[model samples]
Target chain A: MRKLTLPTVLLFIALALTTLSNAQDNIWTPETHMKVKRIGGTAISPDGEYVAYVVTSPVMEGEKSEYLSQIWVAAADGSFNLQYTRGEKSNNSPAFSPDGKQLAFISQRAEKPQVYMMRLMGGEPEHWVSPIPTSSL
Target chain B: MGWSYGGYMTSFVVTRTDRFRAASMGAGLPNLVSMVTTTDISDYLVAHMGGEFWDDYDTYEKHSAIYHFKNVVTPTQVIHGQNDVRVPFTQGQEFYEALKRKGVDTEMIVYPRTPHGPREPKFLMDVSERIAVWFEKYLEE
Candidate 1:
């Protein structure tokens, strides 16, 4: 509605350029990638009440970095979010049983990746099976 | 059922069981011996496979799908990236060749200059379509 003003236009252009330059400077970096929490696997409960997923975060392992993943459960309606598993090594590849009473996941705690099962109600995770090369072959 | 390691899993399961009618393997490490030498994660393979290929031939041979390709009957669609350094295109090439030679229904789709994961939209679409067609052709029967 106002008359053409060169100074006002130049000020707006300068502000836009500064915002663009700031965005360009915030490029993706290793630090940012490390901070990203990766969802390795996810499965919805049969009843559709909760969702099980694996959340992995990068951790400094001496000079190197490694992913430490654990299974987590979240309410379908976003009411609650809780960590379900713990300990060293990674616990990933979550799969909910058809009845939704059990959750199975793979872990490297036994040196080789093995399937472990847990009842959603409560209790310690039990090692269901270790289908390693030696056992399978 | 999987990609990469899952790709390897699909390949392995088909050999042991014919329950799966078809499979889509993406950037999979089929041959552990070649993988240890060719992949960007050579040290990881070497450590996990337990020593170098020369030092542990049994471990490499036992795990390598190339060694067991003769037993695989399920039709497989191997989707790979030409520039995949982690699991080289040669892995997919080898599996496709073996399956073809064995008279198994198989196909290989290599996305040009693509990395481990297909980045280009066109390549991704092509891969998904190819997989769908492969499954439709094999499973629908």
Candidate 2:
């Protein structure tokens, strides 16, 4: 066996710890560089068969950039997740109403964060709640 | 957690602060992942001794309720762990008091001798059940 120097042991330990942390963080943070990683919204479909969520991420451009978010949905079993939200703007927190026919979420499409709702399958956006404080004096 | 009000993905968080906060508050929100480490990460956070990610004003006070807690709405419940060093017990109290002042429906519970996220089985069951009940009561019409 060869003698191991103290520094060599320290270096080995550091490398081991670094590798361990990376492995752990990867598992904790699902996927890579998510458009939106934080909690935005969750909705169980009226039939309880589908779920939708809002995801946001920052996209860097040649100059100043802003947060971009969209709505993504998947089956209850985690299948067929697709981006349902449009526009390159920021959106988040996609939630299905208890009735399951309508979906609600927060968006910055108008340049400020506020909640909005849309049909589960298509067309026309309705403003639900404004982030503008109704009572914040 | 079942989605923090301030838009934090406590669901994705893996820290002691998140876990104990979940448990102590009786959150039924499932824990996807939580750190079970040798060093009490709570203490590390309490000491304010970790590398700061929320250093920039926007990040640190990302809607910080610190020192100013008056705009709380909705009936609220606050739960805390005595041994929680991550967010510290003080923050909970501040929140609790704020909700109380506004007279929002609220309740507070503190677990004794539990860290941020104790693996104690009973605590897990308690937290989950409580959260479900709370949602049913408040969110469900």
- Residue A46 shift from truth in candidate 1, angstroms: 44
Q: List A-chain TM-scores for all predictions.
A: 0.75, 0.60
Q: What is the lDDT of residue B122 in candidate 2?
A: 43
How far does residue A87 in candidate 1 sit from its true spot (Å)?
48
The digit string of per-residue lDDT tens for model 2 on A37-126 reads 454667678898898877756555554344566888778887677777878676776778787777787776785667788887776779
Candidate 2 has an lDDT of 0.54
**Per-residue alpha-carbon lDDT of model 2 for B19-127, expressed as tens digits?**
1222123221211112112223534432442334334344334324432234334455566566665445554565566556777566766666655543333444455
Clashing pairs in 1: none
Which 10-residue span in candidate 1 chain B carries the lowest summed lDDT?
B119-128
Candidate 2 clashing pairs? A35-A56, A35-A57, A36-A56, A40-A93, A41-A93, B20-B116, B28-B128, B75-B105
Candidate 2 chain A: worst 10 consecutive residues by lDDT? Answer: A28-37
Docking class of 1: incorrect
RMSD of 2: 21.1
Superposed Cα deviation of residue B86, candidate 1 (Å): 0.8
The C-alpha stretches of model 2 lying farther than 4 A from their native spots are A1-40, A134-137, B1-141
How does candidate 2 fare on TM-score?
A: 0.35
